[model samples]
Target chain A: MSKAEKTLLNVPKIQADFPILHRKIRGKRLVYLDSAATSQKPRQVIDATTDFYMRYNANVHRAIYELGEEATREYEGAREKVAAFIHARSPNQVIFTKSTTEALNLVAYGYGLKGPIQAGDEIVGTVMEHHSNHVPWHFVRDHKGAVLKYVDIDDEGNLRMEQYDELITKRTKIVTVSMCSNVLGTINPIKEIAKRAHEAGAVCVVDAAQAAPHLPIDVQSLGADFLAFSGHKMLGPTGIGVLYGETEALEATEPLLGGGEMIREVHLGRASWNDIPYRFEGGTPNIAGAIGLGVAVDYLTDLKMEAVRAHEMEVTRYALDEIHRIPGVRTYGPEDVKQKAGVLAFTIDGVHPHDIASILDVEGICVRSGHHCAQPLMERYDLPATARASFYVYNDSDDVDVLMAGIRKVQEVFA
Target chain B: MADLRELYQETILDHSKKPRNFHEIAEADASAVGHNPLCGDRVTVYVRLRDDTIADIAFVGQGCAISKASASLMTDAVKGKSRVQAHQLFQLFHRMVTGKPGDPVNTAGLGKLAVLSGVSEFPVRVKCASLAWHTLEAALESKKEIVSLE
Candidate 1:
C-alpha cells in the first residue's frame, strides 16, 4: 500500500456521525455511494437545523426584537463560516443562493445577459460541464447573439489543453468551467485556466459544485472572478448554496432578483440595490439551511479539508483497482488519482447502466445511473448513460467492496 | 435477489438481447419518438396503418432490458391488431404495470406482455415498461413531434 493509502481517515468513527448510515435498506445495510447527487447529513448538521427552528425562529434583517437579532446573527455568522471555508477574502464576497444552479444563473443573467456580453462575443465552457453551467450559456448565446464555444475532453476524460487554449480569445467575454466534473471526476487546473482567461481580459467562473465537497478551495489563489457551489453535496441541508465573487465583479454585475431584502431604498420608478451580498440574496432566505451548512462547515473543518481529500484519494484508488479486476468493466476519467476526485463512472459491456443500478439497489447500494445532467458530454462520448459511484468523507474501502460485489452480481445476472 | 428475478425474467432478457421487429421502417407512414430524459432512454415507434387496421409495427432505440423487452413485446402484440384493440391493450398494460388500486390485472387479451406484470413491484421502472406504448400512442395520433416523459 502507498503512503497515501495508509493515511485514510477513521471511516467507522466518521460514518457513525451520520444517522442515515445506521438505517437498513431492503433488510440489508445501506452502502451509499451517491454523494455527488447529495450527501447524507451528519447528526451535528441536523441538530443545528433543529436547534435553530426550535430555539430562534424569526425573520432576519428586518425586525428589532431580540429573537430577530439572534436570527440575523446566526444567518450572518453562517456567511462568515462559508467565507472562511472557501478562503474568500471577505464574508461579503459569499452570496447565498438556492443552489449551484441558481448561483451560476445569477452570474449568467446578472453579468452575462444584462449587458457585459455583447453580440458576436464568445462565451466559452467545457463540453463536460453539467447542464447548470452549459445550458445557461446557451441561453446567453441564443438571446444575446454571443457565440458559445466548448473545450473538448479527450477519451481519457481529461480536458484537451490545446483546445481550451484555442477556444479563449480576445472576443471572449466570459469563460465558465467546472473545477471538477460531476460525471467524469476529472479535476481541472482552475488557477491556470483562470489565469488564461484573465490574460484574455475575460472573467473566469468556476462551477465548484463537485469540487467544494472534496477539495480545499481558495478563491484568492484560484484567481477565479466568481465561484458557485451547492450545500447539499457537502453534507449540508438543501435549498442553500454559495456564490463567491470578487468585490469588483459583484459590483459590476446586476442583481438577478429584486425584492425587499435586495433593495436599499425604493421609489415609485426606481430602486437602489443593497450592498454586494445582500443585493443578490432576495426575499426571506433559507435561514435554517444556512445555519445547518455552517455546522457542516465546522464539521469538515474539524476533520481538516486536507485529510478529507487524502482519504477520498485513497478510497478512489482502491475502488479503481478493485473495479479494474472485474471483467468487461470500463472506467472513465483521468488515469492518475491525483487528477480526479472521488467519482467513478463506468460501464458494464452487456448490462445497461439502469440494470446495473437496479441490481446494485437490491444489495442496498445506491449508485446514480444516466447522463448525470450532462447530455452534451454524453453525446461527446457517444454513450447514452453511465453508472457512477461517488465517495465522501464517511466512505471507506468496505463500501467499495460492496460496490464491487454488486457489479459482479450484475454481470453474472446478465451473463 | 428473488424480487430482481421477477423483474428481469428469462423471457425479458432474451427479448432485450434480440428484440423481435426491432428495426426502422424506412417507409413508415406514422412514427413518433419517445424519450425519458431522466435515464436517456429513447424509443422511436413506427407503424403502417392500412384502412385503420394495424398492418405492421416496429421500433428502434437504446435503453435498459425492461424497456427494450417491453418494446419488443409491444410490437409483437400490436402488429396485427386494429387501432382500437391496440389502444385497449395499451390501457390494460399501463394499469397492469402501474398497479392502479382497485384495477386488477386483466391478462385475458395481453399475451407475452403478462410476463411484465412484475414491473409494479418496482415503481420507478414503470416508465421504462411504458415508453414504447406511449410512443405508439403518439404515432397512432399522428403527432409529428418527439414525446418527452419528463
Candidate 2:
C-alpha cells in the first residue's frame, strides 16, 4: 500500500473520536457529509468546554479570584495557540468574536468604515464570497460612497486572475477574497492575489472560514493584512471565532464596539483604547469556547494538517470519479482534485437539490442543499441551488461509498 | 419521525413532476412572487379575480418537490373559492403544517392539503410547504412586494 493510503486507514479510528458520528438517523447509520456547514466536535474539544464551565466558570480579565485568574489564563492561552496555528507573529494580533460573520463585520466597521476607505475608493472582491464576507463590503461601499468591484470566475470555477490585473489599481484601497470558496471548494491562490493587491498599495483581507478547517493557513506567507475564521467549522465549539490582523493593520483600525475590556481609561466623554487584540474584543468574550478552540487546535496540530489534507483529497478524488460514472450527476468546481478541496457540489438531471437532500436524509445521509450563502456564485452558474457533500478529517472512503449509495437511492425514488 | 414515503407521497410526487396550472395567466389581475431564500425556492403565483371570487389561478416558478407540489396543489384547491374562503384555507393549511408533533391535524376542510400534514413531522420543511400559500395570499391582497418565508 502507498504511504499516504496506509496512514489514511486510520480515518475510521479518527471517526470514533467524535460522539455524533455514532448516531443513527431514520434507522440507518448517519453518513454526515456536511462538514462545510459546521463540523462535528471531537469528545476532547467538547470535554474541554464542559470542563471550563464546571471547573473554572468565572469571567475572564476582570476578577482577582483564583478561578478568574485560571479562566483568564486559559483564554489568553487560547489566543497564543491560535496565533501559532496561523503562524502569526504574536498572540496580540488575534481577536476573538462570536462568529466569522462578526469578525468580518468588525473589519468592515473598523478598517473599511473608520480607517482608510474613503469616498470614491474601490474595494475588490470575488464572486464566490459568502454573504458574511460580501455584505460587509457592501456596508463599506454604501456608507463611504466607495465603489464595489468583483473579480469574476471562469467556466471551471477558477478565479479570472487577469481580471485582478485590470480591476485592481491605485484606485483600490482594499482587496478582500476568500482563501477557499464555500460552494465550489475552489482553493484560491491568495499568495498571488495578495501580491498583486500589495503592488497596487491595497490591503488584502482573506476570508479563511472554509480554508482554515481543511488547509494549513500561514497569515504571513499569504500576506493577509486581516484573516477571519470560525472555530465551529474546525472541530471546536460554536460562538467563538478568530480574527488575525497584523500589528500595523490592527493599530490603524478602530474598534467596532465600545465598553469594558476594549478601553484603557474612560473619563466621561473621553476614553483611550486598549491594546491591539483587546481593543477589538469588546465585552466579556466566549471564554469557554475559546478554551475549547485551543484544545481543538491542539488536536489538529497532533494529527498534522498535511495528513488531513491528503486524506480529504483522496476521498474527493474517489467521489469525483464515482459520481461522474453516474449518468445524470454533474459535479461543480474544478475537475482536478488538486485544484479543489473536499466540497462536492452537484446537480442531478430533473431533480431539484432540495428533493435530493430530502431523499438523502431518509438514508441518514446529511448533505447541504442551498445556495451555500454564495448567491452571487449561484447566479453566475444560472442555478437555483446545488446539493453539496463536504468532507473533513473524520470522513473516509466508506463515508463516500455510503454517499454514493444514497445518491443512487435518490435517483431510484425520483425515477 | 414521519416516513419519507409519507412526505414524498405518490400524489405529491405526481404533482411536482407535472404541476397543474403551471403557467402564467396573461394580464394577471393579481400576481406575487414567493421566495424561500434558504433553499433558493421561488414561485410566482398569479390570480385572476372576479369581484370577490377567484376566476382563475396559475403559477410559474422553480422550486423543490415539496414547494412545487405545495404550490401546484394550492392552486387547484383555491381556484374557484372566494377570496375569503381561499384565505381561510390558507390559514387552515398553515396551522396543519406548523402543528407540534403528535398534535391532531385538524384536516377537516383541508381536503388535498392534508397530504402535506407530513411536513409538520419534518419541521425544517414547514417553510417549503408554506411558501406558495404565502404567495397566494400576497396575490389575493395584490401586495406589490415579493412574499418571503425567510
Candidate 3:
C-alpha cells in the first residue's frame, strides 16, 4: 500500500487503541472532536504510568536503592525521549514542568525577568498567542518596565509578516510567538521569525503547545532559542510539560523556583545551582507522567509524524470543503489546508456558541466553545465566542460526517 | 442525562428569538454590567426604582439562549416586586439551578423562572442562567462595579 493509504487505514486501528472511544455518550456513539483541548490516552500510555507506580515508585535523583535507580533511569529516559522528539542538541536541554503554562512562565521569569529584559526594552509578540504565551510577556512589561508590541493578523488569521519584520528592531530584547494558533489553527513561519529575531540580536521563544502534537519539529532548524509544549495535549498524561532551551539560553537563565534538586551546594542563606535541566526542575517532578509521555512519544514515533500530519490534513480538508455548504456559517483562519492545521473555529448566525455547543453535546459530539484561551485573537475578529472542532489521529471522515449532521440539528432546533 | 427539550423549551426559544425589554433604559436610576469571562457573555441590566419598588427593568447585551431568555423572563416577573421580594426570588432561582442531584427543586413562587430547573444538570451552564439575576441584584443596590462570574 502507498504511504498515504496505510496511514488512512490506521485511523480505525488508532481509534480502537483509545478505550474511551468504545463508550457511549447520551446513549449515542461518542464523536470526540476536541483534541485541541486534550487528546484521549491510548492503553499503552495508560499502562506505562500504571506500571511505574506499581513496580518502581520512588523519588528520583536521591536514593541509591534498586527501585530508586530504576525510577531515576525511567524519568531521565523520558527527558531523553523528549529531547530527541524535538531534535534538541542534548537531553540536558529539556526541563520538565507542570504544564505548558508553567513552561512558558519558566522562560518568562527565568530568562526574561532575570536580566535579559531591561527597562524600556521591547518584547514583540503576536495577537494570535494563547494566554500562556501572551500573559507572561505582559508580566515582563509590567514589572520590568519593558514595552510590549503586538503584531496584528490579516482578516484570514495569518500573521502579517511585514508587521512582524517592522516590530523587531535593534531595541527588541525578546520575540515570542506561537508556532500554531490554538483557535485559528494557522501554522506560522517560525523558522523565518526566529531568524529575524536572531538578526535583531533578540532571543526567540516559541510556544509549541499547539504545534508539537500535530507537526514535526526540528528545534535546530527552527532557530528558536526556547520552546514549550504540554504532554497532555499530545496524548500523554496531564501535569507534565517540556521546555527545550538552547545551551546558551539555558545557561543564562536563573531558576524560577529554589528547592532541593536545583542546588549543587548549599550554605546558610546562599547556594550554588546544579546543571542546566536539573536546576530548572526544583522539586521532585512528575515521574510517572514523564514515563508515560515517553511511551506516548514512542507511539507517535512508530506511527511516523508525517503520517499523523497527513491524516489531519485530509480530515481538515474534508471538513473545510463541507463547512461552506452550510449557510450562515463563518469560519476563522486561513482557508487553505497547507496554511492551516486541524482546528475549525466557526460561528452560525443568529445562534450563540454556548447554545451550539449544548446542542452538539446532545448528539454526543464533543466540541470546544469559547474564546479558546485566545481572547486577544477573538477581540481582533470582534467575536464574543466561537464553537471549535479540532481533529487528531483517531478522527476520520466518519467523525466529520457526524459533526456535519450535528450542526444541521443545531440549525433546525434554533429555526 | 437531561434532554435538550427540558432545557431549551419552546418558551425559552421564543423569548431568546424575540427577547422582551431588551433595550437600554434612558436615564435609568441603576445599571450594572455582568460578565461571564468563561464565554465572553455580557449583559447590562438597567433598573428604574420608585421608592424601593421596581418600576421598570431592562437589559441589553449578548449571550447564549439561556441567559437572554432568563434575562427577558426576569424583567417580566420582577417588574412590580419590591427590592426585598426580588432578592428573595434571586436566592430561590440560584438554588434551583445549582441544586445537587436528588435535592428537591423548590420552584415555589419561581413562576416562569422554573423552566431553568434543567440547568442543575448542566453545571457548566448555571452561570449562563444566573448572570442576569446577579446583574439585577447589583443594579438594585446601585453597585458601581461590573458583576463577574469568572
Candidate 4:
C-alpha cells in the first residue's frame, strides 16, 4: 500500500501517530480491524500528549503555577470540543471518566443508585449491548431491587422496537440503551428511543460508545438526558471517556467516586458538592488525555461526520457481500449494510472463530474473534461465538478485500 | 502472499483435525470445564483416577480446532500418568507455549506434544492452544469427576 492510499481516510499523513501499529505480527503488515475495541491514534493526538508532558506537565486544578493554568485551560477546552462534537449544551455537561465502561457505571452508581429505582421500579435495556452498558444496569437491578426489563432482537440482530415500545412505561425510571450494538454492528434508533423514554416520563441514557466513533450523534436532537462514549474508540486515547448529562439531571445524581476537585465546602463531619461538572469529577483529571481527545474530535470534524458515516456504510456493504459469498461462511448483523455501522460479525462452517483468527493473524489481518463481550446476544442467536471485523475511517475497501482473502484462506485450511 | 508455515505447522493442523482421545471415557475420576470467554471456546475435561494415577481422561465441548485438538491430545497424555506427573506436564506445556526454555526445549517425554511447541510463535493463539490444559489442571485439583468450565 502506498502512503497516499493509506491516507484515503483521515489516518494522518505520517505513521508516527501510533508506533504500535507498525510492529509486525507473525511477519506481516497488520490490517487492524478491531477499532471497535480501540482505535489507533493520530500524529496530532500523540504529539498533543507529548507536547503536554514536555512543556506543560503539571497536576491540573491544584497548582497556582502557569503550567497548571495552561493545562487546565487545554483540558477543559477539550471538554468544550467534545461537548460540541455531540452537540451538548455546554462543557459543564461533559464529565471525563476512565472509559465508557466507567461512564456507564458512573450513571449506575451516581443516578440509578439514588431512589427513583424502588423495589418494584423497572429499568429497560436491549439484548444487544456491550457488557459495559449491560453489566452496570444489572448491578443496579440486583442491588436496588429493581426489575430488569429487556427488549428482544430480530433474527438479524436488530432490536425489536415494538417490544421496546411496549416495555417502556411509567414504571420505568431508567431506560438505558446502547446507541449501537458493538457485536452486531447494528446502529440503533436512539433518537426514537430517547423520544419514547421522554414521553414515558423516564430518563433515557444512550451508550454511545460504539455509535460516537462511527456515526453522527446530536445529543440535543436525540433528546437523551445522558450520553456515554470512550475516547479510544473514537481515534483518541484510552483512560479518557466522555459522559454527557444535562446539568439539572447531573446535579440530582451523586458523584460515583469521592475525592478532591468534586467538593465545595469541606467540613470535618460533612461536605457539599461544587457544581454540575465538578460534582462528577472527583479527582485530579487526565489533562493530556483530554487534549488528545480534542485533537481526535478535530480530526473527525475535518473529515466531516456525513462522509464518515457514508464511507463506513459502503465498506460494511462490501464486507457483508464478499464475506457472505465465501462458502461455508455465515455473517451476523444486517445484510443491508446501510442499516448498520462498518462492523460485521460472522463465523466459518466447521471452523471455530479462534482458529479463523489464528489463521488470519498469520496473514497480519487482525480481526476480533469470540463473544465480542455480548454473550447474551450470542445466546439470543444460539451461537457460541463469532468472528468480527469492524471498520473505522482508517479502513477502506482494500482492507475488506484483504479480510475476504484471509477468510478464504481459513476455509481452505480447515476444509 | 503470506505463508501459513510461519504460524500453523503441519503437525498442529493434523492434531487439530483428528484429535486423539476425543471420545468420552465410560468412567472418569474428576472433570473440569475450561472456557475462554474471549473466544467462547468451552471444554469440559473428565478424568478417571486409579489411586494417585490418572486411569482415564476424556474431554467434551465446542471449541476451535486448536482447542479441541489440544484437549484431545492432553486427555490422552494424562490418561495413565500419575496425578503429580500430569501437573508437571501442565506446567511444562504452559511454559512451552509461553516461549520458555528456548527453541528446542527438553521435549524428552512430551512425544506428540512436541508438535504443539510451534504454537509458541503465535502469542494470541497460546490461549486457544492452552485452554484444554488449563482445564486438566483444574480437574486434577478437584476430586469431583466433573469441574467448572474455566
Specify the highest-DockQ model's number: 3
Compose the digit string of candidate 3's lDDT tens values, residues A36-133. Answer: 99999999999999999999999999999999999999999999999999999899999999999999999999888885778999999999999999
- Which window of ten consecutive residues has the lowest lDDT sum in model 1 chain A? A1-10
> Higher-DockQ candidate among 1 and 2?
2
Q: Give i-RMS (Å) per prediction.
A: 2.0, 1.2, 0.9, 3.2
lDDT of 1 by residue, A1-415 (tens): 4323475577788989999999987778999999999999999999999999999999999989999999999999999999999999899999999999999999999888995889999998999999999888888988899999989999999889888678998899898899999999999999999999999999999999999999998999999999999999999999999999999888889998899899989999999989889999989999999999999999998898999999999989989989988989999898688999999999999788999998898899999999999999999999999999999998888889899999999988888
Candidate 3, residue A312: CA error in Å?
0.1
Candidate 2 error regions (>4 Å): A1-9, B102-106
Query: Cα deviation of B146 in candidate 3 (Å)?
Result: 0.6
Please give the DockQ score of every candidate, comma-separated.
Answer: 0.63, 0.73, 0.84, 0.59
The deviation in Å at residue A321 for candidate 2 is: 1.0
Query: By summed lDDT, which 10 consecutive residues of candidate 2 chain B come out lowest?
Result: B99-108
Superposed model 3: Cα runs more than 4 Å off: A1-9, B101-104
Q: In model 2, how large is the Cα lDDT of residue A117?
A: 87
Q: Candidate 2: TM-score?
A: 0.97
Checking candidate 1 for backbone clashes, the offending pairs are none
Ranking according to DockQ, highest score first: 3, 2, 1, 4
Compared with the true structure, all predictions reach lDDT values of: 0.92, 0.91, 0.92, 0.81
lDDT of 2 by residue, A311-373 (tens): 888888888888887999998999887889999999999899988998899889999999999
Per-prediction TM-score of chain B?
0.94, 0.97, 0.96, 0.82
For model 2, state the Cα shift of residue B135 in Å. 1.5
- The clash tally of candidate 1 reads 0
